[model samples]
Target: MSTTTYAVLVLIGILFFVAMDLGKRDKGNDVITLISDDDDQEEHS
Candidate 1:
C-alpha cells in the first residue's frame, strides 16, 4: 500500500476505537440531568 493509504487507514482505525470507547461509557441519565441543569440555569439568568 502507498504511504497515503496507510496513513488514512491508521487515522480511521483510531477514530473507530475512540467511538467505540465513547459508546461503552454510555452516560445516559447523568448527561440528561447535566444538560437540563445547564438549560435551567440559562433560563434563570
Candidate 2:
C-alpha cells in the first residue's frame, strides 16, 4: 500500500479508538483518591 493510504488508515484507526474511549462511561471518580494526614502529635509537659 502507498504511504498516503497507510497514513490515512492509521489516522482512522486512532480516531476510532479515541471515539470509543470517549464513549465509554466511567463508574465514578476511580481515577485518583487523595488521603491527607494533617494531624500532628505534640508532647505535653
Candidate 3:
C-alpha cells in the first residue's frame, strides 16, 4: 500500500529472477583467458 512496500516487492522479484539465472549458468565454459608471452619474456629479462 505504501511506496516502501511497492519498492520492496519489486526488489524481491528482481533478486529472485537473478538468483534463478545465476543457478542455470555454466560452471566453467564461460572463462576468458589471455595468452601473453610478455610474462615469460619478463621473467627472463
Q: Model 3: C-alpha RMSD to truth?
A: 6.3
lDDT (Cα, 0-100) at 34 in candidate 1: 94
Candidate 2 residue lDDT tens string, 1-45? 699999999999999988867655452233322111222222221
Each prediction's TM-score against the native?
0.55, 0.52, 0.51
**Residue 3, candidate 2: how far off, in angstroms?**
0.3
User: How far in Å is the alpha carbon of 8 misplaced in model 1?
Assistant: 0.2
Who is ahead in TM-score, 1 or 3? Answer: 1
> In angstroms, what RMSD does candidate 1 have relative to the true structure?
4.0
Model 1, range 1-45, lDDT digits (tens) per residue? 699999999999999999977875787667778999999999999
Q: What clash pairs does model 3 have?
A: none
Task: For model 2, state the Cα shift of residue 6 in Å.
Answer: 0.2
Q: What is the lDDT of residue 6 in candidate 3?
A: 96
Whichever of 1 and 2 has more TM-score, that candidate is 1
